[model samples]
Target: MPDALADALYELIVATRILANEKVLDAFGHVSVRHPLDPQRYFIPRHRAPELAEISDLVELTLDSEPVRPTDFRLYSEKVIHGEIYKARPDVHAVCHHHAHAVLPYAISGQEIVPVFHLGAVMGKVQFWDQRDEFGDTNMLVVKPEEGASLARALGPHWTVLMRRHGATVAGTSLRELTFRTVFTCDNARLQSQAMAHGRVDALSPGEVKLTAAHQLRPPSTNRAWDYWVRQVEKAGLMPARAAAKGASTTAARAKKADAKRAPTKSARKNSVKSKRRR
Candidate 1:
């Protein structure tokens, strides 16, 4: 079995891929897990083909976006966006940022991740920064620390925020919960978009939203929702446990072959020596 960290990290990465494959994440996007030992830092898999990531590939970065790898100094260019979010929100241990087809209009629009449906109520009355200085038509704002700070203020206490014309953000106290926010926010937005397609939309009442919030404020229930979503990922075979297992076996076999090749051969030195002493 994988170590605790590896298991959890892979689970999160797999979940991110599932969302990406579902088209929740576009050409460029990310999900990060806060380091348990270091609150000021997090781990994220760097560039090149989102579909190809493994537990060991994730690199840790400081809030300033520096990686331990000297060659990886580039880090996640906009990693400060996530860093500031982690710093500002004590309740959040995971965050997801990605683009969505239906969310694009809402991202750029004056609209917020409002409680348009029951699922959205979990976000605790969503809000938006509405063209913040740092993120004008972009998903990131790590160009400057002050600008990133401004974005943090806009994120506020809500679990969801829409960066106009860029994308959406979701934070949760746990990896599962954050992923739940990430997954459900898109779902709720799509549903709202569909409903609004009729032109005459019936917005959820404040009282109704509040009632939903009361029931889903925390769980017993929301946790179950998060777990169920993970199972759904498994059921759809996107988790692909078999693939993961096969990959592991293949890796082990390659390592064994490498070790055998590197092993000292009794005749190896004789094979390379001069006839004078090698025999």
Candidate 2:
């Protein structure tokens, strides 16, 4: 494709797969990007197993929520939510929806994604919209247009939204920022979920949160580096099935394998057995 959107989308998909293989997203989450050639259209991959997605799996959708079906391709039902948001808000270009375990409990409870971790500290005071009664689709609760508007209103200027009883939604200017934000969203949730066990969690003050959010900028180079590394990892010996389907050439694969073998899987220190955190 002439547009760079596909490359960008695929990078996020690979980044997403890294999360799934790492046990962050199971099989039910999704990540999407605005079609560079078609702003009124967005690209969302089918609701397939996360680890198996590639650039080829993505389907295009209209702003009114119609999936422009390619030959033999199916659409994910949650497009109802994603499409509505794109139409309602012009600033958002990418939207990530996932059911990370750490955030589900809070989502069901209608609680806001609080500023517990430094990331959440950067996320300003989040608003929890009270519109569950309007949402009846239990499997994909964000179905109604009115409910979408409610959620968007709740998200107001914030980059993330905790969809009550369903999952969380994050919007960003580009795929990389969206990917990193999604990971951090889950990490913050995991940390905060753990902290609330003790007592009330401390949230950064509004001014502090604003300052952090303003200063948080991953340069284009940083996102580019992340995208490249994630794709390299995905093309490595990550999942046999996915690798068999659309992995790198034999020579590239061999080189990646050799590099990974040289590097440590669990830890550099043999006795400690510590895990490396995926960025």
Give RMSD to native, each candidate.
Answer: 12.0, 13.7
Distance from true location, Cα of 81 in model 1, Å: 1.1
TM-score of 2: 0.73
Give per-model TM-scores: 0.74, 0.73
lDDT of 2: 0.62
Which pairs, if any, clash in model 1? 107-164, 108-165
Q: How much is the lDDT of residue 72 in candidate 1?
A: 31
Q: State the RMSD for candidate 2.
A: 13.7
lDDT of 2 by residue, 36-78 (tens): 6557777666657767776656655566455443224555556
lDDT of every model, 2 decimals: 0.63, 0.62
